[model samples]
Target: MTRRVPFAWFARNILVGTLLGGAYGAIHDQVSWSISPEYFTKFKFEQFAWAEIGLEPRLAASWIGFLATWWAGAIAAYAVCRMAFRHAFQDGASSWPLGRVVRRLLAVLMVAMAGGGCGFAYARMRAQDVERLWGGWRTYAGVQDLEAFATVGSIHNFGYAGALLGIVLVAVHIKVKGRVDRSSPQSLPPPGR
Candidate 1:
């Protein structure tokens, strides 16, 4: 039987994952803000009540980003630790380690970012439709440039969807790696770990 995630360190892994996800979200939201500040000014600021607190729009948006996605990282870490570390041991050898787990989850972050970028591009290309069809379109009627606001919203939407998909993909990848390593007799733990 293979070793599961080392219980002692999994909490640390979850913390790192949560922080990383927050950073990604904050950065992504900054980009979205750059593209359409109204997305934050008219929508997110109010939704998060930062506008009421009189915080700077950009700062508020960044906080919103972090709050929105930090949990995603924790979930991702748990899934990765469970799936990938089960393959950690085989034939009295340990293969996957916590460091490797972090790296793999970072790959998941990249995949999610890629999806966000694509969503931004697609929404930009169809800005008019996005603005018209966005669920909050009427709520944001006062927005100076409704299309830009909606495009940014679409970017956020696509990013969340992408993160979910990215996790699934990463899970499949690690599972395949587990299967491959299971067949080999060479999977071994690091010398000092």
Candidate 2:
């Protein structure tokens, strides 16, 4: 059995998490745009139907970013909070503080960002091979823009991979930390009846 978590805290975390995720997605889209404007102008704009909206490209990209990722953040936060409260229960704590939970989740964000960077680097390094082989984007735009489109796509794809990695890492860390706490002398009962 586990201690109870207040519904208020749960709701707050969900709201915060959604906002955090949306902000990350928006910022990421902006950076991706900087890397390759063609990546959005030729592909994502049409995919999101933002092309007809007539907004500036950067604003459109940011909106798409928020729309694409806000739910992801909320989902991730919900799962993480469950694990965290469970961890607190195992550690004999009354509750897991919200601030610490946010900090821990920030680590997940950082890991995902790093993964996206690695993806961008990897795509650029292998541009010759990846672009030549992945002709999927050819129908969307001219060949001249293939490299940019492919690289940005790689960034988005790898970011998801990174988020997965972060979740795993955080789970493992929570489990290990709980074990260490359980085994500590302070967690033991005194000998005398």
Which residues of candidate 2, in runs, are more than 4 Å off? 50-54, 90-94, 188-193
Candidate number of the best TM-score: 2
Q: Which whole-number lDDT from 0 to 100 does residue 7 have in model 2?
A: 80
What lDDT is obtained when candidate 2 is compared to the true structure? 0.79
User: What is every candidate's alpha-carbon RMSD to the true fold?
Assistant: 4.3, 2.7
Kindly list the per-residue Cα lDDT of model 2 for residues 91-148, writing each as its tens digit: 3223466676687678778888989999999888988886566686686475456777
Candidate 2 least-lDDT 10 residues? 87-96
Give the poorly placed runs of model 1, Cα more than 4 Å off. 1-5, 50-54, 90-95, 135-141, 188-193
Tell me the deviation in Å of residue 49 in model 2. 2.1
TM-score, each model?
A: 0.84, 0.86
